[model samples]
Structures are given as C-alpha cells and as structure tokens.
Target: MALLDIKGIDVSYGKSLTVKNCSIALDPAKICSVVGESGSGKTTVIRAVLGLLPGGGSVTAGDIVYENRSLLKLSKGEWRSLRGRDISMIFQDSGAMMNQTRLIGKSFVEYIRTHESISKQDAWKKGAEMLGRMRLPDPDRIMNSYPFQLSGGMRQRVGIAMGMTYQPRLLLADEPTSALDVTTQAQIVRQMMELRDEYGTSIIIVTHDIGVAAYMADHVVVMKDGRIEDQGERGYILNDSTNAYTRKLIKAVPSLGGKRYV
Candidate 1:
C-alpha cells in the first residue's frame, strides 16, 4: 500500500464544493508535486492531507489513509499526535507560522521536547545539528537569533530543518521557495532533495513553478479550479502532454540552456 492514499476526496466550503473528487496516492521515499495557479485548490489538497482545513470547511467526502490508518476518522488529539511526529509541513512564509519573540533555538528545542521525551539540552543539540545539515553558517548564531533577525531564505531553512527534525514519514511543502531569490530557491530545493535521500521521507510539494516541480518531483499532479487537470510521471508530463493546460504551463517557463532551440 502507498504511504498516503487519498481516494475520491471532495472538500467543501459551506454548501459549495471547492474540490471535486480529487484523488492521489503518495509512496514512501518519493516526491510528488501539485502544481496550479492560486485559488485552484492545490493548497486545499495539501491542507486536507494535513487536516488543517478551516473550521467551516469540511471534507464533504473522501478517505485519507496514512500508514494504513484512516485519517478522516481520527480525533483532534489523534491528528495532533500525527502532525509533528508522523507528518510535517514547511510553509511559504516561515515567519507567519513562527513565534515572533522567541529565539529559533529556544523554539526548536521546545518543539523537539514536545515530540520526544528529551532533555532541553539534548533538544538544543539536535536543533543545532539540523540547522547545520541545512547548511546554515554559524548554526549556533542562527539558532540563538529570533525569526525576524534572519533573512527570508534563512528563516525558511530553519522551518525546513524543524519540520524534518523528527524524520516524519510524510513532509508537505507549500510554496517553500516563493519568497526566495533564484539562487536561494535552487539551494533550498537541493537541500530538500538531500533530506529525502538521507531519510527516505515521502514528500508533497505544492507550487506554481513547473521548473521546480520538474526538478523535484517524481510524480506531478496538475490542478485547475479544484479539479485535477492531469497526473503522471515527470518524464511523461514534460515530454508528452495531452492536456492543453499542462502544455501551456510547461511552455511558459524560460529554458535554462541559454538559447531556445525549440
């Protein structure tokens, strides 16, 4: 069985349905990308996977089975337990999700303690280790500083490090590189790939950039207006697309070969 099986899911905001019979399965040790424009329900798919949909919004119909467990039936407490330990998410805006006043090290240490029965000192050590793994220079200093003190790329790295701290079986990234420059974006993508290589973690990345999806995803799902436009392997989507929407998306990105021979 797949690590995460989402079958025939329909999400509704009030009486109106936003997502219509969406379905995708994610395997362990692989990366899947969900690409679509804003308001296309791509983010909603990931939110439902994480069980973080808004209060009024509900899963009108679906089954989210993670590790053979039915996530749709899980209680709030049970979902909370699964969140950080079994699954984690790295958001687009790192600071928005973080405590403004707390230092990175202090917050990370506390987060580790909550998930595992570890001493504060040990948690600090582990947090520093993860920051180092993300190639954060002077890890100690970055950890000691608050979220505001770091640049957008630096804060995003910290967010990624924290999410991977427990080696979650599933990792969700929501527009992770949107706030970064091109160079920084490339670096972050490489780091995330390395994380999967090292830990064998399953990943679901939601983004608008097809280039990023091409570089990072084993499988790609294209979404439009709350429905799936196309879903397939990267090679197939890049080389042979039957859908017009998917074709336009692929063509919109600039080529990296310095000259457009095509």
Candidate 2:
C-alpha cells in the first residue's frame, strides 16, 4: 500500500482557495518532488499532509491518509505524538527556524524530550550522534554552538539530522537546498538521497528547481496556478511529458558546456 495518499485535496486560506484538486500517492522508500514557480501550491500540498496548515487555512475537499489513517481527522494529542516520531519536516531556511539565543544542543534536546522521556544528558548525546551521522565534523563543538555560528550548509545538515533522528517513515523537505551555494546544494541533495538509502524513508520534496527535482525524485509532480499541471515517473516527466508548462519549465533549466543538466 502507498505510505501516503493525498486524494484530490483542495485547500483554502480563510475564503481564498490556494490549492485545488491535488492528489499524490507515495510509496515506501521512494522520493517524490513537487516542482513549480513560487505560489504554485507545492508547499501547501506537503503542509496539508503534515497537518500543519497555517491558521485560517484548511483542507476543504478530499483527505490525506498516512499509513491508512486519516491525517485530517487527527486530534491535537494524536498529532503531537505522530509529528516528530513518524514524520518530520525540514524547512527552507532551517537556521532561521531555530531560536537565535539557544545553543543547538539545547533546542535539539528539548525537541527530543518533547517526544521521548529521555534524560537531558542522553538527549544531548543522541543529538550529537545524529549530527555526526550527518557528517558534521566535531559534533561536540557544533552542539555547543548557536545556529548563527554554523554555515548555511551546516545548519541545513543539522536540520536534516534532527528530522532523521527517529528515522521517520516520511520526510517532507520544503526547498531544502535553496539557500546554499552550488557545491553545498549538491552535498545536501546527496546527503538526503543517502538518508533514503540508509533508512528506507519515503520523501516528499517541494522545490522550484527542476534540475534538482530531476536529479532526486523517483516521481515528479509539476504544479502551476494552484493545480497539478503534470505528474509521472521521472523518465516520463523528463522525456515523455508533452504538457506545455512542463516543457517550458524543463527548457528553463540552465545548461553548461552545451549539455543541459537535467
């Protein structure tokens, strides 16, 4: 069975409809990418799956089913229990999401304790180990540092480490590599693919970069004007799709030495 099924969902913010008739079914241990320009509702689709729609926004049609359970119906307590343990999200600017005043370890420990009853020392140790797994050198020093002290790539790795701490069955990443340089973006993408290989985690990545989507996704979903313009397996989306918008987006990818990266 599919791990997550988003069935024809429509989302609205107050009276303004932002996402319409969107559906995606993701299988276990696979990566799916939703790509589009800004405001195309890519983020909204994943946020709906995570049940973290901003206040005044709600799913108005269809349903989101994770592990055959309806996420739309989960109570607050249920959501709290499920969020970090079974599913986790990495934001676009992970450093910006952290508390500027707190050390990385402090925030990480608090996050761990929120979902588990471990002691502070144990949580700190675990957080450091996770950071090490992300390949950050000198995990101890990193733990002692604040988010501001780390480079953008390091901060992104820290976010990925935290999200992967529990080996969540599903990982939602929203433009995770957008803020970094070309080299760092490549590193982060490779690391995320490695996480999927190591943990058998299914991933839903929302991005605007078609090249990134082509490089990582097993399935590709193209969104335009709050709707899915085209979707298919990677091969089909990259080569067989005849949709005008999809073709336009693919053509926009930059080329180097006369070879298009995608």
Candidate 3:
C-alpha cells in the first residue's frame, strides 16, 4: 500500500479554487517531485497534505490518507502528535522561518522537547549530534550560535537535521533549496537523498526546477494552472511524455556546451 495518498483533492483559498482534483500516491522509501511554475498549485497540494494551508485556505473536497488513516479527518491534537514524529516538513527558507531573536540551540531544543519527553541537556546533545550528522563542523559551537550567524547552507542543513531527528516516515520539502547558491543547492539535494537512503523515508518535494526533479525523483509530477498536466516514472516523464507542457518544461532546462544537465 502507498505510504501517503492524496485523492482528487480540491483546495480553495476562501472562494478561489486554487488546486483542482489533484491526486498522488507515494510508496515507502520513494521520492516524488512535483514541478510547476509559481502559482501552479504544487506547493498548495503538499501544504494541504501537511494540514498547513494558509489561514483562509483549506481542502474542499476528497481526502488525504497516510498509512491507511484519513489525514483530513484528524483532530488538532491528533495532528500535533503526527506532524513532527511521523511526518516532517522543511520550508523554502528555513532560516527565515526561524525566530531570529532566539539562539538556534534554544529553538532546536524546544522543537525536540515538543515531540519527545527529554531534558534540556539531553535534547541539546541530541540536536548537536543531528547537526554533526548533517556534516556541520563543531556542532557544539553551532548550537550556541543564532540562526543569522550561520550561512544559508548551514541554516538549511540545520533545518534538515531537525526534520530528520525522529526518523519520520515521510518528509515534505517545499522549494527547500530555492534560496541558496548553486553549490549549496547541490549539497542540500545530495543530503536529502542521503536521508532517504539512510532512513528509508518517503519524500515529496515541491520544486520549479525540472532538472532537480529529474535528478531526485523516482516519479515526476508536472503541474500547471492548478492541475496536474503530466505524471509518470522519471524515464517516462523525461523521455516519453507527449504532453506539450511537460515537453516544454523539459526543453527549458539549461544546457552547457551541448550537454543538458537533466
């Protein structure tokens, strides 16, 4: 059975229908990438699954199921229990999402305590260990620093470390690398792939970069104007898809010296 299934969901922001009849099924340990231009509703789909829709936004129809349970029917208390332990999310700019006034260690420790019953000292040690696993040097010093003290790459790694703390069954990343430089982007992408390999975590990544999608996803879903324009296995979407929009996006990928990156 699929680890997560989104069935014919229509999402709305107040009266405006933003996502229509979207469906996706992700199996255990698989990576699925949703690619689309801005406002195409790719982010909206994942946000709905995580129940993090904006204040006025909501899933108006159909259902989201995770591990045989209906996520749409979960209560606030149930969702609180499920979010950090079973499913975690990494945002576009993790540093920006953090409280700048607080030290990174403080935020991380609080985050850990929220999902697990642990003392402050134990949580701090665990958080440092996770940061070390993500390859950040001198994890102890990192814990003492504030988010702004670290570079963009470092901040993103910290986000990944926190998200992977519980070894969640599913991870949702929304344009997680968009705010970083090329080298940082590559590092973050590689790290995410490594997490999947190490923990067998299923991932759903939302990105506008088709090249990244092709490189990281087992399945590629192309969205346009609030609907899925095309979807299939990576090879099919990359080489065999006849959909005009999909073809156009693929062709738009940058090439250097006659070699296309994807």
Candidate 4:
C-alpha cells in the first residue's frame, strides 16, 4: 500500500477552485516532488497535506490518506496529535516565522518539549546536536543567539534542523531552496536526501525549480493552472516526457556540472 495517498482532492479559496481532483500516491522512504510555475497550485497541495490552508482555503472535496486513514476526517485535536509527530513541514523562509524576542534555544526547546516528554535540558541537548548535524559552525552559540543574529543561510539550516529533529514518517517541503544561494541550496537538499537515506522518511516537495526535482525526486508530478499536467518516475519525466509543459520545465533547468537534464 502507498504510504501517503492524495486522491481526487479539490481545494478552494472562497468559491473559486484551486487544486482539482489532484491524486498522488507516495511510497515509504521515497521522494515525490510537485513541480510547477507560481500560482499553479503547487504550494496549495502542500498546505492541504499539512492541513493549514490559511483560514479561507479548504479541501472542499476528496480525501488525504496517510497510513490508510483519511486526514480530512480527523478532528482538529486528532490532527494536532499527528502533525508534528508523524508528519513535519519545512517551510519557505521558515526562519522568518520564528519569534524574534525569544532566543533560538528557547523556541527549539519548547517545540521539542511539546512533541516529546523530555526535560528542557535534554531537549536543549538534542536541539544542539541536531544543529551540529546540519553543520553549523557553533551550535551552542547559535542556540544562544536570536534569529536576527544569524545569517539567512544559518537561519534556514536551523529551521531544517528543527524540522528533522523528530524524524517524522513524512516531510513536506515548500520551495525550501528558492530563496537560498546555489551552494546553500545544494547543502540543504543534500541534508534532506540524507534524512531519507538514514531515516527512511517519505518526502513531498512543492517547487518551481526542476533542478531540485531532478536532484531529489524519485517520482515527479507536474502541475499547471491547478492540475496535474504530467507525472511518472524521474526517468520518464526527464527522458520520455509526452507532455509539452513537462518538456518546457526540463528545458528551463540549467545544466549542472556538465550533467544533462535528461
């Protein structure tokens, strides 16, 4: 059985529809990237999976099933119980979402304590270790610093560290590398791939960059104007596309280290 199944889901803001009957089934420990241009409903799909649709937006039809249970049917409390434990998300500009008044360690410890029955001291230790794993130069100093004290890249890595600390069964990433420089983007992508390798976490990424899809996805789903334009294994999307939109996406990706897109 598929680990996560999104079947025939329709999302909307007010009465105007966005995602129309979009269906995707992801296997455990694999990466499936949802690719598209802006406003193509790529990020909407990620929000639906996470059940945070910005108030007015909602899943008006269809169901999201994780481990064979429908997420739409879950109560708010039930969903909360499952969200950070079984599923986690890496948001675009996640660092900017952090509270400026609190030290990074305070926020980190609080999150860990909320999710696990650990002492604040232990949570602090765990948070520091995770930061080190992300290759931060000084995990202790980072923990002691405020969000404004760190660089954009550092802040982004800290966010990634926080997201991966629990090692959830599934990870949702929304344009995780879009604002990052190429080198930092590559590093973050590699760290995420390592999480899949070391912990067998299933991942769904919403991105406009086909280069990121090519680097990390096992399966690819292309969206255009709020619909699935094309989908298949990475090889098929890269080497045997039958859709014009998919072809355009492939052509847009810059050649990497003399490696062809195909």
RMSD for all candidates, in order, please. Answer: 1.9, 1.9, 2.0, 2.5
Query: Cα lDDT of all candidates, in order?
Result: 0.91, 0.95, 0.94, 0.91
Question: Model 1 misses residue 19 by how many Å?
Answer: 0.9
Give me candidate 2's TM-score against the actual structure: 0.97
The residue pairs found clashing in candidate 1 are: none
How many clashes (backbone atoms < 3 Å, residues ≥3 apart in a chain or on different chains) does model 2 have? Answer: 0
- Cα error of candidate 2 at position 133, Å: 1.3
Cα lDDT over the full model 4: 0.91
Model 4 over residues 1-262: C-alpha lDDT tens digits? 8999999899999999998989999999999999999999999998998899988999999999999899988998888778877899988887787999999999999989988899999999999998998788889999999999887777888988888888889999999899999898988899889989999999999888888888799999999999999999999999898899899889777774765746
Once model 3 is optimally superposed onto the true structure by TM-score, how far is the C-alpha of residue 126 displaced, in angstroms?
0.7
lDDT of 2 by residue, 67-120 (tens): 989999999999999998899999998999999999999999999999999999
lDDT tens readout by residue for model 3, 1-262: 9999999999999999999999999999999999999999999999999999999999999999999999999999999999988999999988988899999999999999999899999999999999998898999998999999999988999999999999999999999999999999999999999989999999999999887888999999999999999999999999999999999889888866655555
Give the Cα-based TM-score of candidate 3 against the true structure.
0.97
Model 4 — TM-score against the truth? 0.95
Off by over 4 Å in 3: 259-262
For candidate 2, the per-residue lDDT at 105 reads 95
Per-model clash counts, in order, read 0, 0, 0, 0
